[model samples]
Target: GVTAITAVSPAISARQEDTAVAVANVVMFGTLAMLAYPYLAHHILAADSHRIGMFLGLAVHDTSQAIGSALTYSNVYSDEVVLKVAAITKLSRNLCLAAVVPWLTYLNVRAETKDDEGKEEELEGKKSAGGKSVLAYVPPFVAGVCAMAVL
Candidate 1:
């Protein structure tokens, strides 16, 4: 997420750092989601062991925290499947990050160059950077994600 924001940081006009900080904000929510889900599961959903594992796996963003919490849950409930589900779900979220690059790059590029479209520059001499190559915005970490996924 830091990498994703860094990839687009150069293009944003207003709230430039906010774009980067948004990633951390999202991760904060992931942590909150992780902490909140267990209570939600027990009191609200009345979840069983498998669902609890899956809920946590889907909710938590940090792997170590998820694994640690899963271990706690496993010990608390005497079920190992909770740990497995958490690991799988966290991995699944990381895998999806691999596929998000192209679209995110496109959005960043679009936001950067929202104006000066379809004009041959009859008025002002300024031009939007709408023609930036998509490849230019792809972060190096995305390659690591691809390699990890491949391996």
Candidate 2:
């Protein structure tokens, strides 16, 4: 997963750990995303019995994990509904990447201006076009992310 991120996020080339941090954050988010799924599912599916999809989708970061977990759930407690729910919910969580990039871009813009001490550090390499306006170079990946957002 980290290997694949290099192609999408050119900024990751500046620091290898960026890739690790990005992937790890999303995977961890996937785990956390499941936190409310059970409660919601119990209320929504109070009469219906299938919930494997909710569990698999909430816990999984990748399709393989979703499929594997759903398969296991199927053998133990669920049916075809497990696969359907898992696919939809996992995909919903995965789409967060589209939203996350915009927020990171906002933080990046903010960081260019101030630091932890609230002092405006001298920018070493890329100077601002004007003393007042901060310049931003939005990468092609962001265009794709925007397109995903539009969809």
Candidate 3:
């Protein structure tokens, strides 16, 4: 999702909304899976062990949510490690989304600047060609990078 959004450059906000929709869809699916899987597993897989049900819930339901849920249930559940790791992994993925959106913004802004310069040059060819090459776009390419590093 992060990769997809970042690649879309200039459409950061729209892409983010798209990502939210996708995540919402996945969350809904996970919710349904959590409810359905336990019943199926209880009847067919392990009638004696409730642990299996819990594990399946974490694996299939809201996997990321389950990890967070597991932290509080560590004393009650023996296999908390797996659930914790999975939750952290999901969080890591979400963190990537933060980066993706900003990068797309940068790209979009840069592209816009480039386009604007091109248009101005087109309309004022006689004036610009004889005077100087524009440095209007340089601030973003060079100064922006420098400022970004300082930040």
Candidate 4:
């Protein structure tokens, strides 16, 4: 998710430093989540397979870490259901990335448009005097993702 955000950062006019900070934060927290979530599910929550899976899926930031935690939990507890549920839940969350990036870009463009006070100027391709389409604001990778989804 952070990687996708960083890829679209240029289209959204995000600062490099901000993207760097975001990557750093995700790496730090994602590692911690990977290490901590299994223990939390097994010991702290004392939850069943379904609940443990849901907890890990929702709590962890990255898909790999979430699945890893689930695998760890399942291996320790000898429950395959936990791994399955966690994979499904985490994948469902991952799908949200397709919508989130464009929505954030739209919001950023809208704010910039408001700041421009109706001036006919380009702001990150959201608007342009050259009459560029709204697609101008979409990052190429996002279009590729949509294409892959269609396929």
Each model's total of backbone clashes: 0, 0, 0, 0
Q: Which residue pairs collide in model 3, if any? A: none
TM-score of each: 0.65, 0.51, 0.38, 0.77
The TM-score of candidate 1 is: 0.65
- Give the per-residue lDDT of model 3 (tens digit) for 8-73: 323433565767776676677666654555455445645434454345534553444454444434
Can you write out model 2's per-residue Cα lDDT over 1-151, one digit (the tens) per residue?
A: 2323543454222466777788787666644544444444445666253454766676665555565555555555546677677777866665665555445544555566686798776655554323432224335564675577678
Task: List the global CA lDDT of all models.
Answer: 0.63, 0.55, 0.45, 0.75
Q: For model 1, state the Cα shift of residue 31 in Å.
A: 4.8
Report the lDDT of model 4 for residue 4: 62
Cα RMSD of all models vs. native, in order, equals: 5.3, 7.2, 10.8, 3.5
Give the candidate number with the greatest TM-score: 4
Tens digits of per-residue lDDT for model 1, 36-120: 6656665554647677787776656566666666776777667788778877877777667666766666566556655567433
Model 4 error, position 130 (Å): 8.5
| lDDT per residue as tens, model 4, 96-144 | 6668777776666665555346653445545633345446666666666
Which residue ranges in model 2 land beyond 4 Å of their true spot?
1-14, 21-50, 75-78, 115-151
